[model samples]
Target: MLSRLTQRLTRGSGELREAAAAAGELGPRAVSLVPALRAALGGPDGGTTTPDLDADTAVAEALWRIGQDPGPVVAALDSVFVRAAQNPWGRWAGVRAARAAALLGPAGRPLTPRLHPLLGDPEQVPAAALALVAVADPASLDRTALAEAVLDAARREADPMGALRALEALGAGALSPAHRRSLAALADGDARVVRSGVEDRIIRGDETFRNRARALL
Candidate 1:
C-alpha cells in the first residue's frame, strides 16, 4: 500500500496530495515512505498558489504521521526546516515544519529551543505554541514558559479558529492544571461563545484539532 502511494507521490500533480494523505492514513506502516515523502517536501520554493505548495503541506504533514521518533521522518522535516531557515520563501513552510517537530513529541524536544523564537513571531505563534505544548515534559522545558506562550497566543489571536487549533493540538487528555486554568480563563462574552462552540464540537468528538478548526470555519 505504501509502495503504491509512494510511486504516486512522484507524479507531480494531484497524485502527490493523495499519496501524502495515504501515507498519513497508513501511519507507522508507512514509515518506509519517508524518503519519498521527504523528496516531496524538499521544495524549489514554489509560490503558495502553486500545486507544489499543496504537496508540501500534505508531505510535511505526512512525514510526521509516518513516525514521530528521531528517524527518517523527523530528519526529513529537520532538513526542510534547515533549508526553510535559509531561504526567504521558507517562512511560508515554517508552520508545517513546526507542526512536524511537535508531532515527534519527546524525540522532537531538542527542537524546543530552536522553536522558541517563533513563539513571539506574529505569523508563527500558533504553530510554535502547538509545538511547545507537545513537549512540556516539566523536566526539560520551562512549563511556565510553555503555558504562558500558549495563553499569550490564544488571547492575542483575532480568529477563534486559530486559537482553537492551537488549544486542541494540546489535546484533552494531556492538558495540565495550568493549561486548564488558562483555557478556563478565556471565559467572557464573545470569547466564551467561541469556547462553547469548541466544547460542543468536542462533545460530538471531532476527529483531530486541525479538523475541528476546518469544520468550525
Candidate 2:
C-alpha cells in the first residue's frame, strides 16, 4: 500500500494533486502523501531556490506533513533552511528559518547557532525563536536572552500569528499579565486562524475563544 501510494504521489502530476484527491476520497490514507510531499518539496526542483508556485506548494505541503509527523518535518525543514541559506536569495533565510522553527516538534532544538544571524532583526527573529521555544528543551534556552527576544518580537511584529506563536511558546507559566492581554487582543485579528490551535491550548478555560473567533468577518 505504501509503495503504491508513494509511486502515485511522486508521479508526473505532482503531490498536491494526489494529496488533495486522496484527502477527498481516501480519507486517512491521505496521510501517506505527507512524506512524499516533503520529498518533493526538498527535491531538486522543490522550489526552495525560487519563490514560485512550486515553492509555495512545497511550503504548504511541508506544513501539512509537519502536522502529520513533526520530527521528519523538522528534519526536512532543516534541510530546506540549509539549501535556502546557500541560494542566491539568502536574505529570505530568516523566513525559512522561522518556518522551520514553527514546524519543529516539542523535543527538537538546534544545537548549532545557525539561527543566530536572523535573531538580530526582530521582525525575522520572533518566528524562529518561538519555534525554538516550542521545540527546544527549556533547559537549553538562554532564559534571559530568549525572554528579551520574545518581548521584542511581540512589540515589533504587526502580524498577530507571529506574536501568538511567541506567546504560546512562552506558555502559561512563563507569561505575565501583559502577555495574556496581548494574546486576548489577537483573538480578533485577520490572522486568527494561525493562532487557533495554539491559542485554544493556552486559554483552556475559554471555550469561547474558538466560537467568538470563528464569527470574525
Candidate 3:
C-alpha cells in the first residue's frame, strides 16, 4: 500500500520537471503549474516513485517562476502551509514549508496571520520562523512584543533558528548606529545561512534596511 501510494504520488515527476522547465522558458505563465505542483508536493494517494531530488528541484523551479507573481505565490504558499500542517511527517512537508515561507517573505500580506501558532509547532517551527522573518513589516511589527517572543523562544528552545529569525525580524526595524553595528557584526556570527541573508539585505539596501539606515543617518 505504501509502495503504491509512493508510486502514485511520484508519477508526475517528469511532467513537473517539464512544466518547470517550460515555465522558466515561458516566464510568469509558469504560475499555471501552481495547482499541479502543489498537488504533487502534498497529495497522499499519489505514488512515491518520484525521488526527493525530483520533487525538490520541481519546487525550486516553481518558486523561481512564482517570484514573477506575488499574488499567485502567496496563494500557493497558503496551500502549501495548509498541506504541511495536515501531514507534518509527509516526505516533502518541511521542504514545502521552507519554500513557501521563503516565497512569502517579500509579499508582507495579512494572509499569514497563523504564523505564530505554526512557529510553536516543533515540526513546523523552522519554516514558520523563516516565513515570519521574511514577511514581517518592520514598520508594523510591535517591537516590544516581538522582542518578548524572541527572548521567550530563546529560553524555551534549543534550536537557534527560531531566535535568529525573530532577531532578523526585529532588526528590520530602524536601528541606532550602535545597534546597526551590533547586527553588522552578526554578519559573521555562528549562523551562516541567516547571516548571509541578513548581509544580502544589507548589501541590497532592502527597503526595510534603507528605512532604518535613513533614520540612523
Candidate 4:
C-alpha cells in the first residue's frame, strides 16, 4: 500500500493529492514514503519550492504525519506559507498549511511568525489563529485579541468553521465581556449570523455552528 501511494505521489496533481492524504493516514508506518512525498513537493532534491501550492501543502503534511523526520517537513510547510503569501490565488494553500501546523501541535512552534500576521487576513485568520493557539506559548499571545479576530471572522467570513474552531481553541475562559455578548447574540440566532437568501442547508449549518459556539460559552 505504501509503495503504491508512493508511486501515485509522483503522478499528476490529483493522484499526488490523494496519495499524500492516504499516506498521511498511514502515519509513522508510512515513513518509507517520505522521500517520495518530498520529491512530490518539487524535484528529486525536494529543495526547489513548487508552484503548485496545494500539492506542496499536501506533500508537506504527509511528510509531517509520517514522522520519520521533521526538519525537512518544517521547511516544506514554511515554503508553502511563504509561496502562498506571494500568490493571491494560493490562499487556500495558506489555510491548509495553517491547519497542518495545528495538527503538528507544539512541533509547529517554528511557524509562529508566519502564522501571526495571518490573523489580519480574513481568509486566513481563523485557520492561522487556530494554529497559533496550538503552537504558541500562552505568554507570547494575547488571547483576547485572538478571540476578537476570530469573532470578526465568524461574523463576516464566508466559512465560519475555521473561526469557530479557533474560538474553541481559545475556549470560553479567554473571551472578554464584549466577546461573550457578541457570541451570545450569534448563538441566539442573530439574522446576520445566519445570513439571508442562502439555501436552507446553509442556514441550518449556521445554526449548528451557533449552537456549537454557544456550547463553548
Candidate 5:
C-alpha cells in the first residue's frame, strides 16, 4: 500500500494522487508514506492537481494523521505556509498549512499566533479554526476573543461548517448565554450548518473535535 501510494504521488496524475490520498486516510498505519507525502507537498512535481493547493492539503492531511513528532513536518509546512502567506499566489495553502500545524497538536503549540489571525480569512476560515482547536492550550486560549472571531466566520456562506465545528469545541466556561444563543441561531438558520453535526463524526479533521458543536452548541 505504501509503495503504491508513493508511486502515485511521484506520478503526479489526479487518479494516482487520489489513490495515494485514500491510502493516507488510513491514518497511522500509513506512517511510512510520511516521507512521500512530504515530498508531494512541495516537490517539483508534488502531485500538482488542478489548483495544486488540493494536493498540498491532501499530503498535509496524511502527515497529520500519522505524524507523532513535530520535528520536521512542522518546520517544512511552516516554511511553505510562510512563503505562501508572503505572496498572493497560494490559494488556501497557508490555511491548510495551519491545519496541518494543528494536527501536530502539542508540538504545533508554537504556531498558534500565526494560525489565530487567519480565522478571519474568507478563503478558508474553517480550516484556520480547526488548526486553532488542535493546538490551543485551553488554559491559555483567549476563549472570548476566539469565539468572536469564529462567530464571524460562521456567518459567512463560504465555509460555515468550519465555524460550526469550532463552536462545538468551546467549553461552557467559554460561552455566555449570548454566545450560546448565537450558535443556536446558526443552527436554526441553515441546515447546512447542521452538516457539521453529521460529518463531525468521521474525524474528517480531528476526532477530538467531532460533533463538538452538535453536542455542546
Candidate 6:
C-alpha cells in the first residue's frame, strides 16, 4: 500500500493528494515515502510548483510527519501559502498550512516571521496565532495580544472554529476582563453575534459557536 501511494506521489494523478494524506497518517512508519512526497510537491516536471495546492499541502505535511525534515517541508508549506493567495478559497488552504506548521512544534520556529504577519489577516489570524504558540515558547509571546486578535477573528461571519481553537491554545488565563465580557455577551447571543441569516446550517453553527464560547467562561 505504501509503495502504491509512493508511486501515486511521483505522478500528477488526481489521487495524489489522497495518497499523501494516507501516507501521512502512517506517520514515521512511512519514512520511506518521503522522497516521493517531495517529488509530488515539485510537480511531475520536477522544478515546477504543483498546480494543485491541496495536493502540495498534503505532500508537505506528510513529509514533516514522516521524515521530520524541517527544510523541505517548510519550503513546501511556503509554496502553499504563496500559491493559495491567488484563489478566493485560498484562506482555507492557508489555515491548513498554518496548522501543519504547528505540527512541527518548536522545529517550526523558522516560520515565525511569516506567521507574525498573518496575525493581521482576519481569516488566518486564529490559525496563525495558534501556530505561533506551538512553535514558540508561550512565555515569549504576548498572549493578551494574541487573544485579542482571535477574539476579533471570532466575530467574523464565517464560523469561528479557528478562533475557538486559538483561544484554547492561548489558555483561559489569557483572557482579560474585557475579553471575558465580550465572550459573555457572545454566549448570551448578543445582537451583534446573533445575525438573522437565511441558512439554517449557518444559524445552527453559530448557536454551536455560542455554546462553545460559553464553555470558555
Best by TM-score: 4
Model 2 per-residue lDDT tens digits across residues 1-217: 5566557555344454444334325434556556565554544344444343334334443444435544554554555566565665654554645554554456346522556556666666666667666666768767446545655554443333454456556655665566445444545444332333466564552334434423321
120-197: candidate 3 lDDT, tens digit per residue: 544355455556667766465555454444444433332334445545555655344554454444333332222234
Off by over 4 Å in 5: 11-20, 43-50, 86-91, 189-215
lDDT (CA) per prediction: 0.61, 0.51, 0.47, 0.77, 0.62, 0.79
Q: Candidate 6: what lDDT?
A: 0.79
Better of 4 and 6 by lDDT: 6
Colliding pairs, model 5: 168-212, 168-213
Candidate ranking under TM-score, highest first, comes to 4, 6, 5, 1, 2, 3
lDDT of 1 by residue, 1-217 (tens): 8667867878365688788988888888888888887767645454343345446657767876766546555555555555555655666567766876777777776667667776665557777777777754545555455545655655654333445666666555445677666565554223432333567675343234334544433
TM-score, each model?
A: 0.60, 0.53, 0.47, 0.89, 0.70, 0.85
| Runs of candidate 2 exceeding 4 Å displacement | 1-28, 43-71, 87-97, 110-116, 157-161, 172-217
Which 10-residue window in model 2 sums to the lowest lDDT?
208-217
Taking all chains together, the TM-score of candidate 4 against the true structure is: 0.89
TM-score of 6: 0.85
Candidate 6: give the clashing pairs. Answer: none
18 Cα displacement, candidate 3 (Å): 12
When 1 and 2 are scored with TM-score, the better candidate is: 1
The candidate scoring highest on lDDT is 6
